[model samples]
Target: MEHLFGVMLVWLLAAVWIFLLVSWAITGDVSAVEAAFGSVVALLLAIASAQRAFPYVVPFSLATLGGGAVALPVLRAYLNRAAHAQMDAELIERACLAYEFDPKNYGALINLAEVCYKNGLLEQAVRHLEHAIQQAPVMAANEKRRLRMWQDELQHHPKLGYTPCMHCGARSSVGAVRCERCRHLLLPLLVHGRWVPRQLVHKAVAVWGIAVGASALSLLWREQLTGLNALVAILATLSVALGLIVWVVRR
Candidate 1:
């Protein structure tokens, strides 16, 4: 029975890491380091204790850890781009620097186009937008139309640069109140390193409240954890790693 419990503990650890593996899919969460640490340690522990069938655990761990590693750099870059593209006076200079660094950079082209349009430089805006379209041929029709609308608008009108949705990282048009790709509010609050949805954060708080209350009641009704049972519980929680990950990502 203790052996069975040990196996269960390994499986529980596996579950914790599995969810954090595709961290790129939830880039909006902005908890890459936390996800990476949570996943890597749990995965290593699981692999050390795994039974038959997960022969590919080692390579798979690499994929999960590497995906998380990829996220951290991407997040840093996105934040840098956001700072440069927003209402800063050096928008043109920064965009040009990014373009020179990567001539085919889609974000750079889009930023240049918006800057040109805002300054009433129609031909330049069209040129940049055309270049941007080339970089992303699968651009939506509405998005294409949205970018070109600068042609009909007043000169020197503020055609601010595009920004990736804080939640989904999909590009959003200037002045849009919501992200077209994810339908999340465009303006999200920056908590810690992530721009999390206010509603989701509120929900997380309520979830914690309910969870704590339930745990407290259960503890009151039961004997205090000790010995082998306590050991199982600690292992099941990944030695507090899983709990910390949830808190950092949500809080």
Candidate 2:
């Protein structure tokens, strides 16, 4: 209900913006600044509302925003089609067939996951998600996080006879003795019917500690780091530190 309301509000704002722009262009009554400001606000509102409606459509970035703007006419024409694509069984089956033919296609895997999940095919959904995650090494962190969250949610639906890798969290077939990503030994499910790798847990704790410490230091010394040069230096140092830590953890 709230999403519907937001979409309606966005359309209303967009309509007003278009009316104002057209009126200004025709009569030359409204100031340029006013038109520009109104247009910007309307665009922002529309993007926000569209995100609520279609979270997986685009990443939130300036480049994506510009691309979305350029594609706005097409998007508006087929908005309903794009939004409800997953609900079409025929389309989903076609996507699944395509994925089977080319298992490495990350986009097809993700689409299959979504459609399967929506259709209550929990096991298939989980499998597709895991495959997508494994193949998407270069995917953005935010996108990977979203996929992980979805996989985690589906894990609780029912037993799929698969165990998650303790090191990289990828699901492994049951009775497997090693994780595919990190080659870490999978212990017997002696506790809680699941194996929890202590090394992985310790590494996670160390990473969290470093992140918290860095954030605390940044907050405490924010006033002193006033100049652009200082900001750049800090960012560079932190980036290097983070890169090293990630390399070590992945190794």
Ten-residue region with minimum lDDT total, candidate 2: 186-195
Cα error, residue 231 of model 2, in Å, equals: 97
Question: Using Cα atoms with residue i matched to residue i, what is each candidate's TM-score against the true structure?
Answer: 0.27, 0.29
lDDT of 1 by residue, 1-251 (tens): 65455556565645744474445437654356545545555565455445422333333334444443454456446555554434333666567567767878888778877765654445556667777778887964654896667555534555446644667888776534356898764432111224333445434434433343233323322334667775565455453544654764576
Candidate 1 structure, TM-score to reference:
0.27
Which parts of model 2 have CA positions greater than 4 angstroms off? 1-87, 160-251
- Please give the distance, in angstroms, between residue 27's alpha carbon in candidate 1 and its true position after superposition: 22
Residue pairs clashing in model 2 are none
Question: Candidate 1: where is the Cα deviation over 4 Å?
Answer: 1-57, 86-149, 152-235, 249-251
Error at 83, model 1, angstroms: 1.7
Q: What's the residue-level lDDT of 197 in candidate 1?
A: 35
